[model samples]
Target: MSIRHGLLALLDQGPHYGYQLRTEFEERTGATWPLNVGQVYTTLGRLERDGLVAPAGEDGEGHVFYAITDAGRAELRDWFGTPVRRDSPPRDELAIKLAMAVTVPGVDVREVVQAQRRHSMRALQDYTRLKARALAADLSAAGPDPDGPDPDGPDRDLAWLLVLDQLIFQTEAEVRWLDHCETRLARHRPAPAAPQAPATAPQASAPAAPQAPARRRGSGSARR
Candidate 1:
């Protein structure tokens, strides 16, 4: 996640202390990434060094505040304008595991797929439940105009709803992908060959006189 750009975007609005930045970030992103206070300060330092942000004095409580610079504004504009690049996606551990499971010997790829599907389904359910609660709360708070849009209102709840929806969709997608992997594995896996025992044919043989090896010459002479 681009925490740097995220901080810059937040700073674009106004100057804020580290804790404030972290709080606002979580509020907007629904704490999905959960920015740490130390991390916020660290990011602020980098942004200051990079001329994207600057120390804008301190608040009444002596908390140092940061404000976005012209450079940061330009970067934020570009970030909003540019489409997210999908050529390189974040590495998915489950996908890697399934990929190896299907290709490696002694691996039960079907079991792997089922296990991951269960985990993803559970996560999807959790997110769905969270969404339901959020929707219910939003409706309760809105009263009669529950479905009406809020033109000039705080959107923390809405932000959380969007985040939860994204997680739900992502988890659902993973479950579907696991099913796809199982189906594709079945098609790709070769059939196990039947085990064969050693073939031994019984045969009748005629008895024959066996010739013994000649004794050593020295031993025969001694005996004679």
Candidate 2:
């Protein structure tokens, strides 16, 4: 996600201070990607430098407020008009790891892959549990009452349901991918071999000719 674009979109609504922009951005995006105060300021600075945004005025506290310029509005409109290419590129770390796994040593690669899978699985489990809880709460809140219906009730909050759906879908996909990775790693690992004993030096054979040599030496001595 482009922070610059996101901030520009937010500024298109109206002029806002840096802190307000940061807060509103988080709220609109369901706080998915956290925004640092510094990042917001930095993006604002870039937008101002590029003539996409300008300082509108100051608030009571003298903090500079920013408004999207005509150029920024055009940019935002252009962004919205353009279709995002879902197939633009793959930025998945797991995919990168698997691609390079062949070049890495067996144990080292297996360890890294397995570690990633384990972490992914754990994250999936946590997300699943959280989704379940959210669903239960949503259901309870949306449950039909025997006596009366809420005119301004939980049924109105379909926004959270949509967010939950996206979260659950992503988590389930991650879990499936992790499982596939684990299976592939297991298949690629070589089977263990039986251990062998250490090799020893060969023993020398007895000297059959030693007896003849000794006898010749003794005869020679006696003769002398």
Candidate with top TM-score is 1
TM-score for each model:
0.77, 0.65
C-alpha lDDT of residue 186 in model 2: 68
Q: In model 2, which regions exceed 4 Å deviation?
A: 106-108, 129-164, 186-188, 193-224
lDDT of 1 by residue, 85-142 (tens): 9999999888788778767899887777787788888888888888999898888767
**Whose lDDT is greatest here?**
1
What is the C-alpha lDDT profile of model 2 across 1-224, one tens digit per residue? Answer: 88999899889878999999888777655576789899999999999999999999897899899999999999999998998788877497767877787676654665666687678677767767766776786688777789787663453334445665777687678767767766876687664577888898798987876443334445556543
What lDDT is reached at residue 138 by model 1? 82
Model-by-model lDDT, in order? Answer: 0.84, 0.77
